[model samples]
Target: MTRRPYRDLVIFARGGGWGVDRAADGYDPVAVIRGTDFAAVRSGRTETVPRRWEKRTLIVPRRVRPGDVLLEISGGSVARGQTTGRSLFVGPDVLPAFELPVIPASFCRLVRFDTTLVDPRYAYYGLLDMYLSGRAGDYENQSTGISNFQFERFLDAELLRVPPMAEQRRIAGVLAALDDKIEINERVVTATEELLRAEFDALAVTGHGSVPVTELVEFNPRTPPPERAGAPYVDMAALPTHVAGIRSWSHRPPRGGSRFRNGDTLLARITPCLENGKTGYVDFLAPGQTATGSTEFIVLRARPGVPPQFPYFLARDERFRGHAVRKMAGSSGRQRVNAADAADFRISVPSPERLAVFGERAGAAFTHMAGLLAESRALQSLRDALLPELMAGRRIRPAPAPAVTGAATDDAGSSVYAQ
Candidate 1:
């Protein structure tokens, strides 16, 4: 093993992508992967696909290649979990798992590794160790107004410690085991949610009834949050931008965010955040208890007898999200959806008997999804706990057998674009 400059191992790297508004008529739904998408994938939440782009848009000249890793270079992406200056491997094993032709957006750099000099998988894991292990600060340059990672400087000066190919495979294998299970768990949650949506759509097709979202959901519901000592606070980061669940919450004064009780749906009202899919169901709190989150959230709770999870999937609707995005009003960057407009969203409602049945079935599915999320979280903790030690040539435990058989392979046949 020897330490070397990263530039010696990389063949080419650059950033380019057409604006979503600039996408013209074409059959290809060439997806421009932004910093948010990169962060979601890095967190093993690959199911959060951005629907901000037109699927019929033309493919741009800048596209992903096998072995190309998209690294977020600009913005506070590091704090957002994009891991500034880190490489997100887009190898054949990883790309096929996604739905569309995911090209790196303007804020990201596409780095195609020189496979002859470096094993792509190994290089990816090493970068993960560096970035996720909090070693990214040494390689990042946030001095400019924007947080632009100085990849060139890192390539020129940073010492990249590379192990032999055999060792790299072993290390990647061990880490991939934990990641594989996490990915599988994510797939299960995604599939189950899709099925529930399909069932909801079926109910709509049966001519059950149509009603304004307000009839079934209360917008901006009020709550008297507790003090910091006992309050459970959920920030925007605690909510997943793409996935269907909240990642974490804390006991902080519920002083600033919108308030809501259990079974409420929190949909981000701000620009880019709403467009990125930051909506979640509130089940972490007890029935009588309440929680607070970013003021940018619009809380929606089901009316009596309505399925608690129904509003969550309703907010997840493509048409509903489109309407919310269109109704956003304010400056270009600070736009937010008006709660009244959100309440005006129309959706189908099944007959009481049918709705009750759907509620029972959907509740079971959601409960199972939560279980999977919990399992994945625990597995992620184990992996994160072991990542640094394994990367540093120090083994905490005997390396397990390779987990690549199911790793990076999407067995569920989920669409590239989330449903």
Candidate 2:
């Protein structure tokens, strides 16, 4: 088959290298792979780091200009066309990622379709969804894992046989609208959460009313045995931001690295991430469900009036994490937080009436946010389901296979996605 020459389109690397941040996974300011900004940047690490990149930055070539295509050839899993989508600006810091010889830009037809078919930002987020979709599995392990999409395969599987340019544009447009809404809704949720957290932080209930966590809660640690399989397991990756429940699992729950009952709080006791807000309250679990996590968490179990949702807020609270850090900074073996330090950390326990009011209101807000987030994810699923087909000219707004039934969803009556 004669291929279209993409020689004229501008191409650049996509993912930032993980090397700089490997030493400190949580807060490496030198590389963006683990930085604080959940928002994507085109180049340079967003955090302030003492060490600067030895090589070039991550932006695009001056000749190609800003509107040119930004293709990410090598990334998390090195197949091909791993990053299949649209990008515009080339951030300066992104340059160093392409210093190696084995990696190639020309593998997957990385072209700059610098036209109006897709919004660059929307396409960027879409590409991320593609990458994150396969996070269930480690890098390339498949059986129970989702394999990463390399750029080469991406071209063969995605780039080579896309639908007519017009249809690609249409599909991209529809998907962009849904993502745009999702982004807006997410921003609203963040702002609401910030407002609530700020109010909780400033309340005049810190002094005499303060009590040690050990008084009202229990610190129980479980160690994972040599055995690696049996029951479902909760890897660190399973923990998401603001979760009060565990949804995903990888290995079986270990014999005992840590334990948590429903409504217990799980705080990552390690560095960087402990600072990055990686705590969650256990609100939902199946009947007799027992999941274990990496030895990196301090499970907070309340005695009684310590409203269940309170852990959710305290987990997000800077004060709780601050005490957690000061206590662990001097620790010896494996950087773990001691149960006594947890006991030393203090928080004001308001009257049960006040806590009940706070917990009920906060929990309701969390449920609402979770619902919205769940809906956004479902919309994303719909978009993904249609992408390959629509881009391949196999599906469209109106159906071609009239009355044929499958997992495909129409404009309305879509399946509600949840665990």
C-alpha lDDT score of every prediction, in listed order: 0.71, 0.47
* Sliding window of 10 residues with minimal summed lDDT for model 2: 100-109
Poorest stretch of ten by lDDT in candidate 1: 410-419
Model number with the top TM-score: 1
Off by over 4 Å in 1: 19-30, 39-63, 77-83, 97-102, 142-144, 205-212, 286-288, 322-327, 345-348, 398-419
Off by over 4 Å in 2: 1-113, 116-164, 204-210, 221-232, 241-247, 250-255, 329-334, 396-419
Q: What is the lDDT of residue 395 in candidate 1?
A: 37
For candidate 2, write residues 226-322 as lDDT tens digits.
3445545555655655434444455563666666656667788776657656777564445455556667777776567765666656666656666
lDDT of 1 by residue, 278-394 (tens): 899887777678777788899888888888987887788777888889899998899998899877666676689988988999899888888878767766766776677666665
Give residue 303's error in model 2 in angstroms: 3.0
Q: Which candidate number maximizes lDDT?
A: 1
